[model samples]
Target: MKQSKKIAFVAGVASLALLATGCSSSSTAATGAEGSDATLTFMSTEPKSITPQKEPGSQIGMALCANLMEVNSQSQKLEPLAAKSVTSQDAKVWDIELQDGWTFHDGTPVTAHSFAEAWNATATGSNAWQGNGTFVSFKGYEELNPTDGSKASTEKLSGVEVVDETRLRVTLNAPNADFPKLLSTNPTCPMPESAFEDLDAYEQSPVSNGPYKFISWDHNQQVVLEKWDGFKGAEGFSGGADKLVGKIYTAVDAAYTDMTAGNLDMIRNVPATMVDKAKNQLGEQALYEVETASKQQTLQIPEYVEELKSPALRRAISLSIDREAIAASLLKGHAQTSDSLVPPSLGSYVSGSCADCVFDPERAKKILAEDGGFDGTLIIESNSASDQQLVQALTKQIQDNLGIKVQLKPTLGTELSERRNSQKLDGAVFGLWGWSYMSPDQYLSQYETGGDGNTVTGYSNDKVDKLLRAARAEMDEAKAAKLYTEAEAIIVEDLPAIPLFIPTDYGLQSQCAQLNDVQGDLQYYRAGYGC
Candidate 1:
């Protein structure tokens, strides 16, 4: 799960106040020829921050800080990056050994204390960092993130301990064979000492230990990075470009236009409207597509909503939608109809796991009648920034098939997030659940009682919770996957959310750039761009 940990909000126009008049530096444009000192420009949204923990999966942060582990794009397996080795016996207590000679951009050594202190600051409830949820598995996390909403007793997580200058130990509250895989996520990346001294200033332009060092951030215009000549790490870690430029854009369509015009080196998440024309316009070699395991569009039904509490009603809703048609038509075949909540790219996936997802309008009608017909219009809320055409199609399908009056509420992304966080949503909402790591637990664990990622849908089951716990502790990969599958089976029956579609990630590469490696689930930073 190399994608952003934040809810997969639909890409929308960035704030108008942050908009730049035009792209700066004509030299940054794609040259259509390889140059040793070339600059690669990528289309990107305005980043909220450059801090790894604060903005996990941010391209700027990914380029600025090297993580303890990285996912091999081809194998989809974890590999050591900053860390020399991450080992655990019983999957509970782990030891981490850092690679020698790795130094921060500020020229300070990236010692074990750098990681321990950073984790402590992120875990502290007072800090309220977005990445705090990632540290919940560590021992003594409760003391740092108290549920009572009172001040924490201590800022440090007792589980994180520095063994020496290069070695560190981590003790989780429970066994998790995927702990090392979790380290591959950006939130687990270490921060230098200067970050702790003044977090705000560090966030503006932080010191990091990645292949690229931050050069400048031009607010909403662009972020410039220069290759760190002194970078030392595993082979193939260094980038080909002398400089990388993340050019901020208010809209994806505009980015796609620039990419086709040869002004941009690479652009991801090609707009649904442009999906069909991209390959024809840019040629097949320039358009890249891959099935993504990290995220899926879903219709989340909160249990608190009295009208939608019945499982039969929810199942009927799922059965009503023609996912295949929607995927082919509205999405322009850029998405795959999801049969289960889990995407097919993961190991735990089982085809046709979501039996209710089948499109059978007569069965849906009968089930809806048996479950007692709705008294009022069904409202489907979604972020306006999302794919409204797909939303409109879904609403139309439900209205036509189920014979129920429906309303589509397209709210702003920020306002929608605020309403969701406060549990103030008036009806079922369309959203996405993205994983922090490449594990089934990332998807199934949300069904656990009061789980950290369970903010969208208030779903809970005793059997599912027990199965998830068992999966977490199981060291055997196959056994763990079985336990997770069992949990997913139960969740599918409960129908807390309707799995709509697993989108195929799409990107366009400029004629000047050649992608050495492409990972659909990860941000563009993970790919090697030779320009």
Candidate 2:
């Protein structure tokens, strides 16, 4: 399924019908932490907290609220933070220890029980299933044990019992290698013991244990957060500096105006369409830019896709997409064309399949003919107004090239996600969406058959299943990459969905703080330096 969406549209529809960009000088600004700056302003597509529905920029909430067990940005390898160490005494039981002394924003000392209760709620799927830790829940503790021929999900977690405060144990059903890594991301991220008291308040008022604390989150206005001085692990805490200050604003021009006028300090997603204007107004000392992560806005063909279900049809549809032209004309040559769903940040599995993603009306016609062209209409769902324009453009192309009837049904955010997840709709022009992480396994768990979070299309293959299983079970990175590599071949050949285009991140900032390379998946807040 296409997990990507298009909230990054340039403007409302009709306006997007003709998007263009202009050249600008390469001005630079202070990115992040250049002068021990304590506070920063961030730009984002969503709030900084997690909720039932979709929100961009919420990943910042996860990062700033609490440090994961591990963050991958370190050069020495996977950097472990909160957990001193993690080792499975046996296939089922894993022992863990807390760092010297860690406390939540409320000054409550973190103990084993904090993680235990959170893990229990996430792994058991007993609660509303925040859609956080479905993988661990589906497999259960048994998925960790390599004992003979045992694969069961029933029965309680007899092995993952707590020994005492500050120390904990885990019991897996099999020798699942992904257990630790999984903890580093989602299932293991400690939840506020206070979150469950009221889910509604939790969404609006989140308490964090990361580098920052919640100041306020007022919808229809900027959300502000101040850094947590008590944060034990971050650099600012060691220096006794005030916690970082974060604010989110929807309008870049306003934010940029404030920045240049010296009312605001920083922003992300610098709108590239008006690059020349941005550079001149902001000046070199206040402007910053970088080629963000190569992320794609692709079509996630739902597994049970009603009308465009055929692999041949999906492949042909891929042919109808003109990524380079779209990138050049609309995106202002800010990004590259991509034919494969996986971007170039990770592995060899990424195939430079641009040639296949070319516009070919004849080929699409052939495939439709072979599949027995249906007279019924086809619908597309999307959120960004620009996507609707693009979808309409593509629809026109398809209809003109091949006598097929098509329709554009654009919708997004909660409505779009519910339809996609509940199977209430047939198709949508999903774009500008993807996982925040750079791992292929992230994609697998999102779309593969039986994947707890799978929505776009229920793609399944015995080989991919086996490969995913093997990759998850193997502790070795080399082995894991190999398995994913093989799995990718299957995905490419199967063509369950169509690869759209790799899109660039855009935003406007007031000229206070500039940043280097912004890419990868983020929940909502943009990360860079502040003045």
Candidate 3:
């Protein structure tokens, strides 16, 4: 997703896709030759794919590969990695000066056109998903008045130009003052032209250009990366740190088991089921954190043009959730019930809908009885939990309260993500959409009129669109935040979704390990950590 301008939180969500897919490391001599001491053991629920434009591909991809730029976690700032610097003189144009001694894994020198070509190729359709909604807004990719397709094809971008090997130029249809920050995701991380004899194949298994290179991945089994000495670095690196070693596992139990045996040295997530035992076992090596959960469980509404636009229904659904029950049973008190679409930890609330954004099963029943337009078939949604736990729980609550029998269905994580994106979600899907509290991009375009990432709910409003555009356009920090607050109030009234608990990322880790700054993302298994 875009870094800060409009897709930051969405990028956090995309980067976490591997949490569902599930990393490998070598043992250091300080620890052993197994790479356990030297490597970080990571776990992801879903398998990762190799598309720069895709979730794992776009943001933070530089940890494994290099891009033209990188985002600094401490400052929430974007800086050049492959490029020397990027400056936007105006809203539509940016001047990027390339770094001097950059090279790909294959030793091909980095070029301005490589970045431009990569952005151009992955700007539409599925590839667009890779970049976390970044270049989807580029002017060259916009197919205005195309006779064949309704939307523009990202086939050949017309806006980005290769001025020279060191400098590149870009033009936008709309004024995007935050363009540089948006390109900080992994997919936008530049690659050497040498890695791709065929662009499609390269998308499947990309070679790294960052501090690390892809070693091997066995899907549900293991994934690995080795250091790339060719990487060009600057401010983003931890003082030119040595190459990172990563390992991913599917089950927390397996990961925890290995780490406790001293076979694993670093992991961001400490296994919760055995946290007590591990705490006794590893002692101070077992670090504890009151971390924030990036995932937000919201009821999705269709962006129906008319007819079935039901805020009341959305409200009723929101009210039906027994958040207390979910927190007590599923989350085990590790989750915080959200009061707004955007979490409050950002030291601010975006929505003014705090009045009805809460648990009220009885009220939900009453609202549905009076206002819901139920079409007979039981509506259900799902995610990557134990046998549709969330779906089943939601169905039981909705039925017990409203007398509507919803047929719940469970699905794989990737499939569930796809259902939301396609928006043809039959009767509605039950799941969560993760957002970043530290960055603003996730909120701005996420719920806009045409925002693909905004599909969290089918519901959208014209006035809401006006609010989004206003917020995005405002350069004054306070004024833009104020606009967002007002817009949030309008959305709360609209009830496209009801806020649910913000759950924590409960992964098992060694006590001394620390992993943060993945944009509040959980399940960023590939993220490196140390004892």
Candidate 4:
């Protein structure tokens, strides 16, 4: 979901990159011997901010902050990182023990106080950090959000107690089985106290506590990181690469060209247009079609759009579109048709496939007619150029099959996000929605009443809300899975948002390092040495 979150806010800074001239069509890769000398250059969209606690989590954020815990891509289980071990009973009171000798890029020792200070600052309202919402489960975290329009009540979180340099205790407001998984997020990554000294400057050129240290950040251009010899993650993190460089490509075609020329060691989220060609050009060894838990694109109908609020109408709309055709022709068979809101990466995931997900134009027409069929154009909003393509394809299919007038409206991601958050958007919006971690709660909780992820659909179901709450409080994994299954059933029945495709990541990587799945993302850190 970090990629989706990044896309949701990219409109604010995309214009800058769009305005600037493109980089050299083909650049030279840093040539040197193997190991640390072997640098990996990546071409991706620029991250809006890299501030550890405040910025939207993205690949850039992941590169900079080593979280308290890390998720194994293959197993979808938690692995200790900064915190050597975490123990919790009753799913509320948790004790964390940090691994000794980890240090910030600036050579400052990381401690329990570092995390406590960072999380408290991030949870405060005055900082305007988007991550504050993630910590609402912590006890006394409510104080960080003053009911009044004043600054946060306190900088010190009553929930977080630093017992000593290596030990800390956390108390949550409610029992949450996924609390440890939550700590794996970038927002929860600890930052040195000095990060607060100049938040703005720090965001542009932040120090990291990860395997790589920040070297330079050329705004709107590129970010450079080099292996930190002092980094203690050698035992469990990173591969043979000594340096990692992330650069912005004004055009995907340019990125593809650079990847072919070996200027870029890899390029994530490969453009659909180039997926097939990339596979052929890079050969099977280099091309990777990594499956992700991202709900890449979804068709959302807000409750405010009165005409489309009927459950029957929503189902009709969902059934009218041919998802398989879209995946085959438009996506070039690189996409997975998603029948459920939660991706199939988590242990509790269900396909949610039923008569509701099947494509049947006649049945759809009958449902819509019975529901007193529409007379107006359905306005579908697209947040990005890629999304606009998908929206355009959907509009054609929905209009052709349902005989409903569909209008494709393109808008900047930021503007659309604003409209969504304020509950001002009507009709439908086809955009990004995904999970950042491997938990059903990440997807189910969003459907809770007034949840941030529910912005597009404005969906509310008492059964779903109650089931999600029960799942969150459930200490047993099996019980939680059952609760999630029940909640998912309720949501798919409501049909507020129609799942389109489970996102896929396509990239070309040299054998120098193998790609490892980390929480559904195939990242370089987990790569094994080869080339």
Better of 2 and 4 by lDDT: 4
Q: For residue 185, give model 4's deviation from the true position in Å.
A: 1.0
* Candidate 3, poorest ten consecutive residues by summed lDDT: 21-30
- Residue-level lDDT tens digits of model 3 in 330-383: 555656777787766543364434576667878877887788456565566665
Q: Can you list the residue pairs that collide in candidate 4? A: 511-531
Worst 10 residues of 1 by lDDT: 6-15
Residues forming the 10-long window of minimal summed lDDT in candidate 4: 3-12
Which numbered prediction scores highest in lDDT against the true structure?
Answer: 1
Residue range 1-531, candidate 1, lDDT tens digits: 433222111111221211343322222332324444567889876776777887675777877878887754434445677887877756788888888888999899999999998899877867756567678889979999777878889878999989999999999988877787788777787898888788889888888888789999998799999878677643234445668899987666677778777789887655565677887888888876655546788998888888888899888889999998888877887788999888887778999999999899999999989887776888999877546778899999999998988899998655676576557888899986677676888787667875655666779899988898889888667988898899999999989889999887666777655443423454555445444
Kindly list the per-residue Cα lDDT of model 4 for residues 1-531, writing each as its tens digit.
222111011111222432363321111122244323667777755555666565544666777778877664433456677777777756778888898888898989999998998888877867767576677778877788776777766778899999999989999877777877788787788888788798777777788698677888886588887766776542334444567778776555777787777777776666565677877888888877665555456777788888778889889888998888888888887777877777777667776543477688999999999988989988887766344566788899899999999888876554566676556886788866656676788877767774536655778999888888788888767888989988888888887888878757666776554566655566655444444
Tell me which of candidates 1 and 3 scores higher on lDDT. 1
Residue 294 of model 2 has an lDDT of 44
Residue 392, model 2: Cα distance from true site in angstroms: 5.3
RMSD of each: 8.7, 10.7, 7.1, 9.3
- TM-score leader: 1
**Alpha-carbon deviation at 69 in model 3, angstroms:** 3.7
Instruction: State in Å the error of residue 273, model 3.
Output: 7.9
* lDDT, candidate 2, 397-493, per-residue tens: 6556667677777763445655765667676446565543446676655545555455556677887877877776665667777787777667766
lDDT of 2: 0.54
